[model samples]
Target: METVQSQSKNSSTDHHDHGGIFGEKTELYFAIISGFFFFLGLILSKLTPLPEWTSHSCYIAAYFFGGYYTLLEAIVKTRKGEFEIDFLMIAAAIGAAYIDSWAEGALLLFLFSLGHALEHHALNKATKSIEALGELSPKTALVRKGSTTEVVAVEDLKIDDIIIVKPNSQISADGVVIKGSSSVDQSSITGESIPIDKTAIAPNTKLPKFEEIDSSNVVYTGTLNGDNIIEVKVLKLSKDTTISRLVKMVSEVETKKSPTQLQTKKFEKWFVPAVIIMVVALSFAHLVIEETVRESLYRAISVLVASSPCALAISTPSAVLSAIARAAKKGVLIKGGRALEDLGSLRVIAFDKTGTLTEGKPRLTNIIPINGFDKNEFLEMVLDVESLSNHPLARAISKDINSEYGIENKHRSSDIQAIQGKGIRARYNGGNVFIGNVEMMKDAKITVGSEIHQQMDELLQYGNTVMLVGYNETLIGLISVMDVPRKLASQTLARLKKIGIKQMIMLTGDHQRVGDSIAKQIGLTDAKGNLLPEDKVKAIEELQKNNTKVAMVGDGVNDAPAMAISTVGIAMGAAGSDVALETADVALMSDKIQSLPFVIGLSRESRRIIKQNLWISMGVVALLVPATIFGFANIGVAVAIHEGSTLVVVLNALRLLRYDLKE
Candidate 1:
């Protein structure tokens, strides 16, 4: 089977090829060439003692140089029965030329073409984050084949192939380290600035198994290696690497238009035809009123030039793309313009308990020994049995036992079994050992005394998950685990409220007391407890039914349904999980909750800019159309106003690229 490493490499190359088509150099070249001819035509017409016919020839040449590409695009679009801004500009220019105003026609085309070039340049700048990510993977890698290292193209390295990453070089593919250690920078993927220390595991040691690979042992594509040389066994192909998926997601986002963009497009369907009809009607009306043919045609052409919706067409995409790019730089991946627009309208945000608000790492908080059992010995036995389990609470207990009491998994326990939603059971030293919740103890016929029950209640009251340990039908001890709230939880809640989030709710499968405790601590507006996965989905549905736009944030597995049902699904710390990256509408690359507020602020700002651009574009057209009909505006002034409004809209959208959370 081909390894993920090989797939990742191939996909990376393909994504890079896709990105290559968007470079700004081509647009800059066209703009420069068009500007040069425009100046030459102006010099010939006004300053030089050239013949009138020669000046007119110069103007025609300027028009061809400035607008040939746009004219061809318009023709292609026309054949497809779609009318765009290019078609509008070309038609207006033709009308000006027919009115014996060749100079004005040439100038209008030059400005219109220049606007197209600038818009392309601005879009390129806005989507630079995706392009920058594509560039991070190195072209070649040092592969070790049977004790000999040879440089090979990254795409040529297959799964299980060993590659040596030298100091200061980007890792060519995603792999697990089999030899050496290094401090690697993963900011490109996770957005964390600090370098992480990674070490190779011993050959004989069984690595801890989890849903996601541990960051310390896994090296990903495009991450920079530090001073130490490390050998990695490639686990994923280039195309399937974390960076490749991230790049692909960012690229796909631009194609999904926002609500505002869709509205403008709907308006454009009839708006373009209306403008043409208006111009024709105005010209016929002027002729009926005994106006001269030349004067009647001039006013009609002015109306055509003045009514082009160039600014309106560009308003939403420019703002959305710029906002999306800004979010990416901060390690927040907004999947599309739809998510970007939806985020701004969210009145309620639902968060999953574990891994969203809480750190998700449980800790052993309390231990109560019973029946005169040796505290240390009981703890040691619990560690040995739990060592065979992969549950988060089991790992936390084992880690605590190892650290606090120097206990290790040395005992051989047979018949080990996991009880779903309850706990674990194993036969140790020919005695039945049970470690689980209150339900497990009851099922095993272990009687809990008042003292034991009181201890459990106190722990539950404090929001800790209590586990009972029994030996051969006798209650031995009580253990409590607590998954604490993240350090930034309260701060994140405060910022959300400050930014106009009307409600924040947390949903969890933990006991109601536990859920309420964490919710109170984090200042959540509401908390729902003991909810199954389906229950969470129902909660999200309830919020939506109230006409509240909701964003559901979670770790992206058990919460996937709930997130999918909401207006937007945001995955927290999604850098390690492909499912989370793909399933969520928005993925926070890092684990910092503060990024939530920052994203909200960005969305609100983008929405504001889109509104401003729309008003400006439509307002300009509204005022100029009437002025042209009354002869208050000429063709030159109309074209100037139209082109200037387009530029203003583009510049306004570009402001989102510089948006910062500190503002």
Candidate 2:
């Protein structure tokens, strides 16, 4: 649904971002002049001795001010061979004047204009909130020159330029931390509840490409920095920052229409002409009964005013716009009304296993000691050897051990060596320690008993990589590790089910056991693995064969095909990636799983409000036309009721701006 809004002076982004709803002084002056003349003419012509034409001159002044934009819109629609509610409203107001109801005609245009202005004002408040997100990025950055730092415009900053971010300040651009350690609060851009710890990238660590990144070093524009200074190396130009991409998406929402809005447009195409035909037939039908021409035309004008369809034209877009703005505030970008409507009806949601479900890095899950070594003693041996190595597996093990035990590395290792096909080992505490696979332990003459072997077999079934630790040529412990599910993955799935999703599944390129292991941890109904992008699309098709609405959630690059096939394609971690922003129907800027349930609930709420607005608007017309025909209502009363319904629907749609799903 759409309406022709009369803009006062400027509709620029800066105007909407900072200015109040009243636009300028000219709008207020015109409104005051129109109301002053309308009331003066209505009372003077009735109570005092006044020439009728003189009173009409006052009414004409009211029409010129109040109906200026409405008349212009009506004329434009007419030249294009289109008829809208504005044209119908102006015609009915002029018909009232033909019967000498000049005061009532002025009242009609005044109320209609006021209703249109109010609706647009209310819609502006919702849109302004979405635009406010862009304002979070500061205009200037403290750029670091060779000797001293100089303040520069964010737009003037170039790639590879170093900028210094102060404590509790908004990040200036998309960049990486080169020096300093701090926790960057990404809630403004990514909606991650917790602030991410940011540290300078190590000199030895290989950095991933900007197109796909997950490092403690990466920082984005519009996110708040914690209480520490950080020197940032700009990775992107100012225009290509995540904040700019989001601003572009906000502008795009205006052009995209919901299915309901399109249907409303189709209804208006025929509804306007049909109302015109009915009014014409009614005029002649009264004349056939021998009623006077003036009286017949008068009644026809009343029906025309009653059947204006003002509320219907604005029913869907108002709600859709509000919902989109609300979702954007929560760090979820819904492309348009169609996606918002489709998301509400999602029956199945398929998740990509790597980044969507798991944290995409191996984490230690279990550590079991064998023989005489206690758990801490076993971990101390494992940490001492693994911390010296640089393998990915070794890093995973050492990180987990350091996080859990806070080991100070009491024993200084002397002979540390990384076996080519196996893991690493070192001499520590006057004893030889080994950390590797079962084959490495066995090759070193360490006993692998039935109990330890059975334990390793059980861990393998859950898709865990078991690493054996040995000391003095004896078995010490086994450490099981794998990529673990995200912290909120299981809770998010349960919340989705609570909101009426029927099934949850996982589609991934990982092994079947790994996929199932993640599914079990995250409460998914099914898990499918060893699937390429094409296979994911086929899986989406298979789910859709049951005629259910399916949604695909992924990191948004490899899963684009699957997302295209699903009913709703949601991209996770879209804050800085352009491919994710452009590909998915819904882009969750934050990589948090918690946002999934929130977006789903919001879409459902918006859909419900749109349906409710339709009912309220159509229901008013059902009661209105018959009352006007039976002489139970006059032109003044019908005009008042029509504008009243318009205001009612607008206020109802505005309810979505403050909508929140309480868990």
Candidate 3:
């Protein structure tokens, strides 16, 4: 787990993060230092015995303390052969100092510093909920040995280790409940407010029901252990756990950006130069007509200072920050501004079948056996083979077989081979034994009869993937695995439709039946199956070619490439993969699938606000610049309107904060 670092005790925004030394502490120190010098300048200037030079010295000190970073940044930009708003601000303020308007210069520095501090505060506040989730992550897990318990780093916990979870402690890992029951506070994970009552037989067993574990039986990392202690078997370790992945994903999201945000930078490349031209023209005209160079320059500086686009600069990010803040409040962590922009434009949302729409756990749904073999014999032999394998399908077959026979398979064989996209082959009892689907058996020249084919068709109708196992060229038994759709999957898809998304589809690496089953259940119009990561990307490209702005939502390591290819790549169960988070444009913190629509709606609303702010700012600037040149407006009026418009733009952007987004 990453620590959130804090340097000063008095600091309001000190949380340890993995962002190294340049996080909250550095920002706070700069703001505090600037604040100190500002008051120091004011105080030293009032000393009775001090000469003018000493007062000037205090102003210089204030500038160094308050404006040093800005000055250095501006000079660095100059070295890079690019001029920015920083250069313009510094030039105007230095000119104020040259004219001996020390108060004006100091005021300029003070206001700018205050703005910087506020921006930092706003960003800090925006990320607090996400950081809070990180802070609440468990550092240690309890290892239970017989009747004794030992605490160790969460990373040290292993699979099937029974861990004791005390009341109010963070659940240290994801695991099944072998024993105890309690109500778990899953609000952090699901954005659901109330505690969910977890029992012995809660739904979806492979992935532990973090909501249903008996307070006495199971615990999950980042979930609050309830009023009653729970005993749980850890199925995954700390680094591989869901919470750890989410924290890292959130960190990586700061860098995964949206296309619109990048385009906005390009927009600035042109917009900034045009604004400079307007500011220059206003100043030149004032000098020619008014015959007062000093007044003209001051008015010109005010125009530049007013039209600096600082408000416009913050315009896009403010909506982005607000969207992210709103999403975090709802347990959705969108990575950056661009993701928010793209979410608003989504026309099609392609979901992965395994985890995005399905529950991702397989169950034995059907079985078919050849004439010489009964269902039991076939199951027993396949379970014998599956018992030695660790794949999800293997574990599922084993679990189903063991439950039926009440005996664990102990048979072992050598030289086992798995055929990609098919099944397994092994040597057992001095004969060729196959323990996979019909494709695997057929490749080995095993005979398939009409009965097996009929049964396979029946299983396919029910959306089961049937595997035919054979020995000595004769079919032994058939194994079928079915993945259940998520309970809310269809409802979530319908909600997206309500939010104006026209196309909803499912993409999977599973067979066509498996994919189609889930797609139909979720009411999707299209379902593509047996796709690799590259195939998924190709599908996204095809959708985009059809003029559909597609968003691919997935949470697996395999889904990362497709996520990167989509117009907006959204990661479901975001805390599972760093690559998914790093590559995907948006992240859902927990398993609740409904927030996708909420975030999309919020983005559309945010874009509306951004457009409003941009128009209002531009409209006022267009009107006021001409008004100032013709003497219809004085310098003071222009400054007031200019500052007033900045405030108006900010307040208009703030309207996004009031949006209602709930499940």
Candidate 4:
């Protein structure tokens, strides 16, 4: 029952906070200050001929200043029996000091602290998108209380409260418009750059309610309103807003470790103990061979510092964070390192028909009159009845009819009803008007003649969804609608093939012919249609049975279960729906198919960089440990090589930040 503020506070206090210990600035400040003292000590010891105690004092001071937090963390983790990179670095530095190499120890601490600071800064920058989203919604809302409007904190606003949003202001909560009209920029939520026009819904219409959130009548939190005042009745509280859910998802994503990262952690558990044993054995060997304690101890300390797996530990997370940030900037949200890695190895990708490859908005494509009926009269009647329904096809037909003939309803129909998955039924002009799929006609016992059936077949062949319109007992006409493929859908599929995807399939609930037609148009390798949500899940499982890694792309409530069962679930246009964002492992914030290619390419590159980093880290340790034992490298040189490799691996991962789809 914690409030949002308390939840945020607790999350910030967790170890994964982007800005650690006060903030990035404080970490940077301490690193710089400690580096100055370390350099001063180096100058006194090597160049100034100052008293040894003076230089020793300065080195001790530098070590404590630069490594205090790291030392504290090492102790805390050690007490909990979890030895990490901090423990390794601190142990190495202290071992150098134990061997009277104060200058080398001080320098090691300073460089390690600097690298930690830089890593934090880079990670914080990468996660800034989530913070930016959190800031988009207004903190206060103007509530319309009786005759006067009063400003109140968004958290205090309740469901069903009417809030007034002015032009250019961010919405305070998710709600439905009750009055006025405007174009709202929902880019923060849906990643659609174009502002969508929204108007008030008519009272008591058969149209789906605002809870389903039709774009024309629903306004979401964090969207910017255009130049018109609108009254919105809140549907959700501030904590339950779409933006809040999005931020929460982004924050939790980093905690889900990738397979590679988990493997690296497992290696480190064994690697750390082995390194300690090696250091002890090397110290014993050196003492027996050379019989000089100072040099023997120094060599062992150098081995400890050189063989630390800092780079290996950082490899996957740094690359994953950078890629996630890059993808976020382009309106793609990679849920975690696991999804990013899996995307690289996907052999097959299954896509839902609606809202993934195609624009979910259908348009009126054709109208056919039957039994010598007048086309315009049939259209007018169909529009009148369909206007009362909230189906996408109905809206498209109504829009086209309204635009073409300037038809306006003179009177409201009575007893309007929606037959789920079929059509609409209502009383118009003292007679019954039916508009829906062919199933509705069959259910009503209306006979469709051979010629009309032929016409319907022709429409279906072209991937059009045909709706039957009947007046009383006789069929009057047919309305055909099509949801067209996105402009870049074909190009995206081609790119996926070129990137080594072996199979691409379309799965849908639409008619088989309609699905096949769209699949062919988009150049998919295969298509499966007439699927219920469970059918799609079975289809995904069938694909996986062949040992193919599958990714399912969809954006609907029905798609959720199938998406969950797939190897990876990608939600399209997820910014619009909290459920979509939460349900999928990855989310395309914008309704753009092109982002698919970019994300896949980025994942492959991340995997490549991770492998390269691991090789470099293990190679350096393999070479330097033997070299330090055989008297080829000194303590200072070993520390330099180790910290430098860590920096190189980090910088290599940062390359993902500049990766672009256009490139």
- Top lDDT: which candidate number? 4
Q: What is the TM-score of each candidate against the true structure?
A: 0.59, 0.60, 0.60, 0.63
Better of 1 and 4 by TM-score: 4
- lDDT tens digits, residue span 1-663, model 2: 433322211122222234334553333345456667788888879887988887899899887766765676577667878787677778877776776767766766665565444333433422442345456578999998999999999999999899999998989999888898777766444333235568887665666787555556889887888767899989998888876765554445433434444554676687778888878987886547867776778788888766754575567667877888898889887776667888989889998876678776678889888676787777877877887875666778888888877876655676898664466778888988888777788789998898888998888888787888888888878888887888889998999999998999998866788878778877999999767556777798899885788998877334655665577878886322344445567888767778988888888998888889888877877788888877788776776776688788889989999999888
Encode model 4's per-residue lDDT on 1-663: one tens digit a residue. 001111112222234354455564666677677788898887888898678998888888888877875676567667878666667778887887886777767766776665555444434422453555566678899999999999999999999899999988888999988888877866444433235668887776554555556667998887889767899989889988876765564455434434445555665577667887888887777557956766777778888877753564455556777888899999898876667878889989999877677776677888878789987777767877777765545667889888977877555467888664476899988989888778898888888888888888888897887788888898888888887888899999998888888899998766678778988898999988767555777888899896678998887544655666677789887423444455577888877878898899899998898778878877888888888988898876776776688788889999999986553
Alpha carbon lDDT of each predicted model:
0.73, 0.73, 0.64, 0.74
Tens-digit lDDT track for model 3 on 1-663?
Answer: 000000011122222232224565454455456566656666767756666677677677667655655575556667866555556557656755655656445545544544444344434322543454455567887889888889888778888788887776778887765556556765344322224445444444565455444443444577775555667778777776655655454444434434443454465456556666766776676556856776676666556644543344345555666767888888887765546767888888888776667766677766666666766666666777777764557778789778966766768565776554466777776777787666777788988878778878877876876788788777777778777777888898888887788988887766677677667777898988767555776788788885568898886655665676677888876434545655566788886787888889999998788777777766776776567555577655655665576677767767777788554
Query: Positional deviation of 572 in candidate 1, in angstroms?
Result: 2.4
538: Cα error in model 2, Å: 2.0
Better of 1 and 3 by lDDT: 1
Weakest 10 consecutive residues, lDDT, candidate 4?
Answer: 1-10
The lDDT, on a scale of 0 to 1, for candidate 3 is 0.64
**lDDT by residue for model 1 (173-227), tens:** 8888889877786544443223556777568656443215566788778788876
Ranking by TM-score: 4, 3, 2, 1
Error of 2 at 624 (Å): 2.7
Off by over 4 Å in 4: 1-86, 96-262, 309-318, 370-381, 388-393, 403-447, 458-464, 470-476, 509-514, 528-542, 545-547, 557-567, 574-576, 643-651, 660-663
Which portions of model 1 miss their true places by more than 4 Å? Answer: 1-266, 283-286, 289-298, 369-381, 388-392, 403-434, 437-447, 461-463, 470-476, 508-514, 529-538, 557-565, 573-580
- What's the lDDT of the predicted structure labeled candidate 1? 0.73
